[model samples]
Target: MGKLKLLIVDDVEDNRLVLRAICKKLENFEIKEAEDGLEAVEITQDWLPDIILMDVMMPKMDGYEASKIIKNLYPQTVIIVVTAVTDPNMQKNMSEIGVDTYIHKPIDKELILFKLQSIGASIRLKQGQFKTLSKKNALNPFNSDIRSFRIIFDITDTESMMDFGMWLFDQCADKDVVACGRLDLIVELFYKLMRQGMKNQENLSIIVEESYEEIYITIKFENIIVLEPRMVDILNAFESEFIVQKNILCAKLKKYIEEKNSNFEAERTTLTEETIQEIVELKIVKEIHTAPSKERELLRQSFTQKTCAADYVSDIGGDIVDEILDLASLDEEWRERLTTFEEIPSDDNLKKFANGVLDVYAHTINSLFEFTALAYALTSLGIFLKEKAHMVVQDPAKIKTLIMLLENLGYDLVAWRKHIFELQDTLDIHYLDSSFFSSCMQIEGIMSNKEIDVDDDNDMEFF
Candidate 1:
């Protein structure tokens, strides 16, 4: 509710004064300054700040020792070391000693504010952890942020795979597209292709007597199911669309192939061990995929690992989901063609539709893949208003624009699609702030090539 109390510790009086001025300018603060690590420790004993800004090379105790003592005494306090040290290993060493962050010398004011805000958020979340837990024991940001579900369908006919792909797309279309959704379709499609590629009984060159298994990987983001589980059912319905009786047909085909190839495999006896090892490896791989556990860990490591400089999720954010949705809805060729929506090719109507979608979504092309989506555009439209809507369920302007966009486009096909539009409307109605409105006006002017009417007597600050 209130601003966090922060203790700024630096041996230099000028540095302390500079930081104090910056902190005072921030909305809420109980700023206390300490000359060195010894003073920092003494201040903490009487008034423990929510976070500590400690200079690494402070007199009397130096930052590392102070941080160690502070952490031991008050484990809850987040300590960020400020330092002039440029050594690559220094940051790592400070981190090992319980420093949460390191602000290098000549710290930019904006960066300092960003770090403080981030730390402040963490502190507030920590304080309200109990309330959040009581409200939704099932949804923990630390744990429940990710969910994994598997749908293993037997694939016998290649045509069935095609139908399944369509079914899967239809299921996911109503919801936001996620990486998982793309993967789900891939697994289904690959199985179908692999099944089709399998030689007919007479043409089979080699056959294993043991029963083989089929498994595929599908990955999508949690945003798709932000509301309910009906979306997942839509995804699973693809299996039923694959008309062939998969288990029965697969068994018959395997038998036919083994019978035809029984004579050829005996010549390659030496490769048997290698083949067996490969199968074993494949089985291990299958077993390792225990729902979303491995998938989430892989993603977490990819984004959070020190080896990576960017937070992948924050960097790509919502755009990736949009592209995945468009990609899942179309064939590979369509995806490739839509990659560059520079000019609308005159070939087909679907290509034109994709181009429109691409134009709306491809804001930061080089950031990731050069594309955007209706969902992302809609989601981003809510960004400037999201802060005000913190008390409301959703942003109203975003909802209205999203609905209009969807309606103008052809997204009104699925069952209960209206419900989604309505939800977006509700969010927009309650939460849009003046900042968001100003942003919208600017955006609208840019889009419509119209200028805002400014009164000569009035001063209006544009966002």
Candidate 2:
């Protein structure tokens, strides 16, 4: 694509000057200046700039009215709004008006540059060079410039969930880590819901859409989701991760693609709910989840009042898990200890491994949303390792596998903490319970050809 034609629309001369200086840092933009939203629309009618940086509190005509008029006039033009930190309603108002994105006051240069660069790349994707669906699809950006893909899968069973995950990996594996990571975050949220046995026969629809400097992962749930803060209220989730409505939950990841010779990065921005509504086109049934917390957690959530066909799967309790504390530092401690076990397979190291895992089990039990799967898996590994420390130290090869399994087990625990516990991510943690515990059983058979049973009674005996 040619250089991005950018228009900076701010009534204040100083504000326009500063934005001009920042836009100068990026070489791709062929820039312009619009004194107000009216001038912006006038310029669009005559010159048609690719992107517009609009100011909300303008004199002649405000950005809210201007953006709506321009979107209706030329649906293809991208309008990025500027909002003050003091005004809480400015962003929400702009979103309702259908502006592509909003940049907060005390404007950061890096963020603006990233946004422009991403818009430029999406323009490239729109022209039939990269992946292209029909020009009129509800999910795909249709103004001949939006870049995105959609996936619809029913989370009714394990087999379907696995297929959904593998398919997602296939589509996003080639994209950047941020792209894959953000999508994984979305999957984690879905997995937590499905693991709770909320199996609606109607498939959950997800659209991974990219806009100027931002990526949107919007999921449409078949049934209404109910969430009331039990403890800590997660604030500003709308800015970084997810903005939850009733059935449709929108999660986002910020990205800025720096064009390096031939390669480019991935990016995202906000999309109007009307656009989001096109995904499943379900009517509004308000069930709210209002949390604005620094450390995001799903204290308690459930599905309700699903109006699917009679044959369609019904709602179940989606008891989302909340973390007691961060596991990074603790997980790091065990990670180094695993390396130590590799160097010298000693009983001391073995005890450390067992205790370390058991410590995680303790945390899992105390979480508001119960996870017995984790309880059993962590306890079984910890107790079994405590008993077999002597035997494991004797065999180097067996200890190697033990160390490997332990490493994976610790990694999964932290993954749950970071992905599932902290932010929403992939559902792999659900499968990890069976897989990791089964590996622990293999360790048991290797030691004494004995079958070990794990239950609430802590009734585990060896031959």
Candidate 3:
């Protein structure tokens, strides 16, 4: 294994040297340094250190702002704030920004060693879990003949469900099928079917069949309540809505293009003939398509290029949720309101402040990495509820309502996840240095003004 990477970000050279000396005494560490938060962000873009020791107060950018961007983009990377400030408010702000731990300025060697060792052990345990899951079921999917495999398990057994899903990806890996995003899709489909009470002999079967041209998957069970008709209607409605939205977007783009062309033509008399011809050629070459029919086929081809299934599923769930949320525009209003809160009139300041508080809640949930887990948990919950509805609910209307509610909940989770991602993206993209600090200051002010007490009961919603 490669040496674990560590980055020390402090404006004071002596402080960085102190951390560096301590890290040098540690085993298997590759150390790097950055003078301030701006440099730290730049280094992280390429170096992507496993851990960062950051100073809170610095020139150009502060630790809290930098930590927010780094945590948003690389949620897995651990951050420890090494600063002189020991105020409760500072600690609370650091915690909110997703700093893993805090270390005092006058650092102790034993304390540093202990923290490093503890964090290292945790990282190793997570790695062990991944390896165990990947190697649990050693099945090969690459048999020369058309290959098929099926597994039946109780819908209530979440451990088995997760194991089977991992096993399928393991088989794909062994067979060199590169099944990351594809595996996630298969798992989601199984979860969806199971939620509709697909059970045979009190168990559901996940079947995988591979052919020369394609792989086909089926989730089946006896006496399953087939809600295909209603499902089809819902999907068709979503598709129709999507088409309408796409047409509107395309129309807007076309109008904008026409206006630009008119403006360009007005300025044509000032241009040379050759320049005009070149501009016309460039415009023709840059023809745009709002909705391409071949996009799905193109995506399939792109998937064929990936080699590792384990690596692919790592971000597929988050990516899908992000895409869905952006398309639905469910969280756009909150994002806009929070981002532009200061610009709002004093009369509307109260409402904007409330929106900002909700935005903070969204941020807090995201920093906890609850959304990803919630996505999977909701799937399991949906499946469990469907089984109950199947056995106890005699009324078809109740069953339908229950299923629809589950679907809506699933969508809501996606939207929630999407907003969190977008908020982070906005910070990373639009508020790089001073702007980032401004935003963080605003958030800190809001947080300081309110005596927000989030108890376990209130926090349960995120889970």
Candidate 4:
């Protein structure tokens, strides 16, 4: 392929002479001269040059017609139309002829050389020898050869699926030697690796596959093991930082997920559109809600992704309602034997109430972090629900008993600490602490003025 077997075709002899003289600078490319389109077409039939430089205006047949005919007859031939015509229509017509490229005349030697070099590389790729360019050109800007390297991964536990998905996405931000790429590129790469991981049919149950222009990675697993609230909360916080914190960028989200949920089953599978949609709904949508319009649209999109998934039991089928209902309705005999009415004030009952409220409160906070009023209302409702649940085991008139039980379990401190930490991050800590202490002192003053006995049946809502 040395001295790219070049053909120079122009109606003017001087134009051909100038091009031939300049082309002599390149050690690779043997120059052949053709005057007008007809002779160029005739020469192209027997001798297949790696690239053709053709002039647009000529007698008998114009460059556009000749280029079109040559391309139609020999689709592999790379035809670059040379022209002085700047008219939009003429340029458009030349493109319609399937010219490899359009080079404006009154050419600078540097520009012509640059165009020729690009065309030479493009020709090699079209010839299905991209690997050769990769081997020869060490500094090749377009590293298209590495596009073939791809891998996939899978996780079994669907409940923790979102957690792991988000974690892997953050792995792309690793700046250390272990990290793969830029944050944006890493995420894109992770997706490709997950897709590839699904292709290998090993012991994998679920596969996350991903691929990039030069890299690919994947993970696989089966069902997820039960995770504690603290671990889940930590992962959720990282997910928030990745999406919410404007500047933080030290941790890998994927590394955190793997560490926290390593006990779960993982397997490999080809990542179809359905799998990608499930990941988006379960992982991406659950993390961020910075803007109301964006939140609403993203929620709708996630719902649509799930809804559009193929229907299959024991799999990530679309329809949240169906899954919930199936879980609740299954095991009829066990369900019928259970008592519908249970006391909520007993130790067992109070613990259940506390857990329920904690879960609902956590979910509500994660879903709508930006709205203070909404978050407060939801938390208050959770507290109210906890009271109602406790009333099942104790007299409704003796609500103070339930309050005492809740206080003894450090429920107040948990709520207070949660609010304090939440506020500390969002506002001036000193100002918030001062205001909170002042509010506490004022509440104490109000309680001190009241002559209510602790053992009495008087009921009061602190909120």
The models' CA-based lDDT, in order, is 0.41, 0.53, 0.45, 0.41
Those runs of model 4 whose alpha carbons end farther than 4 Å from true positions after fitting are 1-3, 125-144, 148-463
The deviation in Å at residue 152 for candidate 3 is 32
Taking all chains together, each candidate's TM-score versus the true structure is: 0.33, 0.37, 0.30, 0.33
Instruction: State which candidate has the highest lDDT.
Output: 2
lDDT of 1: 0.41
Using TM-score as the measure, which candidate wins? 2
Candidate 1 lDDT over 27-136, as tens digits, reads 66678889999989999999988889888776689887888777666655777777767564765455444455555567657546645654554455446632321122
Q: What is the lDDT of candidate 2?
A: 0.53
Question: RMSD in Å for candidate 4, one decimal?
Answer: 23.6
CA deviation > 4 Å runs, candidate 2: 129-463
Q: Ranking by TM-score, best first?
A: 2, 4, 1, 3
What's model 1's lDDT at 373?
A: 18
